[model samples]
Target: MQGHGYAQPVKQPPHIAWLVFLRVLFVVIGIFSIGFLTWAMMLRLAIVTRKSLDWGVFVAVLAANILSLVLLATEPGDEIHTAGGNLGITLLLGTLVAAIAYYLAADIRHFHRLHDAFTAHRSMAPAYGYPAAPSPYTATTVPSVPHTPPPMPHTPLSQPPIPAPPQRPAPARIDQVRAELDELSDYLRKQDGHHDGHHEGGR
Candidate 1:
């Protein structure tokens, strides 16, 4: 949307003043008969004043003009005059009149406003006005945020392995084991001999 009191200025074309003049002239001439001149001028007006051509008006006028031409070619007699050629001419006239009337009614004030602006301020009128571009130098404030430090990374501690239970030590000397075995053998032999001698004496 345009600002409340500001409008973007544009360059006024040199041909606009004369085109407006010629459009009015063609319209005046078209009152007597619908012709190519009027159609062409209306198209020019649409191109100049609107963002796109006024297709609705263009189609309506074209249809009416074609109807008038067809009716003219047939040359119907007086008996059918009320409903034939007269109707065709009336359709063309009505279409042109309505088109012009609508243009003046709907757009006259806007046109006057543009003309006044152009003359007073040397600014051209936009066909369909545009929203003004925002000023590049305008100041905008950024919101402030509280500072927060990043979290520290986690690391696992190294642990020592558990020790196994101690085993019993073997004997240090082979001579001690041999002495104990010889003593056991001598005791067994003495016991057997004593038994044998007692048995023989009893016999």
Candidate 2:
């Protein structure tokens, strides 16, 4: 359902002494909400399901959001929040949130459908939030893991050993580069080189 709209955000006077205060209070809070959502979805596998389709949408939306923020931050004051740019941004965010809401709504619908089907077939009955006792002779099977591990002759069937990866050696070039950097740093120190190495460049 379309919901009631709130007051549209307005760009206040740019050079006011209070502008920094407003940024800390308002702009930072909006950014923080984005960060919170990111953390909430960090461990989710829904995006990786179906051969990484979730990743494709996630990456696309991430790129769009980044581009929007860049344009938002670098545009001239008048254009930053103008009707066209604002519409584009609003549509992008609306799609992102609506997708999530749609998934949740669809899942609820699916659960209801499942409950109904179960009732019709009498395959499973519910007792206070738990499924009622399954038929005694009905074979119970657990969900199969998405990944099938390769067999190891040394591994015991009862307890699978989790092997830690062996530590890798640092690249030879990295050590050489570190030594060269240290020599150059020492030479520069002897010459009292300007921290910026801008001896020839004029301010």
Candidate 3:
């Protein structure tokens, strides 16, 4: 769970159908002595594949083919013409053969490089059909041990009881009645004096 997953497969570049057509033209040029067709095909393939070496080969071959053709055309006399034609044909055929060899070698090199890259990528990927091993750098969870509570201390069975607080005695009902009567009598005496003063004033 801690390790990396398998790497996704890499996508190859799209193959151009025109490049295949050029290769077919190369085969055709080998069988037929079509003048400068092989050089033309190589030039097209080089442009399609974007290979500088292929382009260079195409240029060199094209130049040789042109020079030979010019010499064959401008030479005077039958013998000189025959010799020039033969030289031109020989140079053309040799250039085509060299171009074919170069193409094959380039293809082999491309395949080998692709294979090496794929192999390196696969080697770094996680194993198939098995779970990844945990990493040493990752944190591991440890199960905690259940804690046991300590036993409670014992208490005496015959300990003395706690004493209740002392209570105050309440006043008797008769004393409460006597206090109220005294207040009532004082109020009555005041009322009587007030009536007597009012009567004297009226008189």
Best by TM-score: 3
Encode model 3's per-residue lDDT on 131-184: one tens digit a residue: 455698885788768999999888769879999989655668778888999999
lDDT of candidate 1 over 3-57, digit per residue (tens): 5555556445445666467557766766655552345545655665773546556
For model 3, what is the error of residue 153's alpha carbon versus the real structure, in angstroms, after optimal superposition? 30
Ranking of candidates on lDDT, top first: 3, 1, 2
TM-score of 2: 0.29
Q: Estimate the TM-score of every prediction.
A: 0.42, 0.29, 0.43
Residue pairs clashing in model 2 are: none
Number of clashes recorded per candidate:
0, 0, 0
TM-score of 3: 0.43
Give the C-alpha miss distance for residue 161 in model 3, angstroms. Answer: 36
Best by lDDT: 3
- Those runs of model 3 whose alpha carbons end farther than 4 Å from true positions after fitting are 1-25, 33-35, 75-81, 122-203
Local lDDT at 105 for model 3: 65
For candidate 3, what is the total of clashing residue pairs? Answer: 0
* lDDT of candidates 1 onward, in order: 0.62, 0.50, 0.69
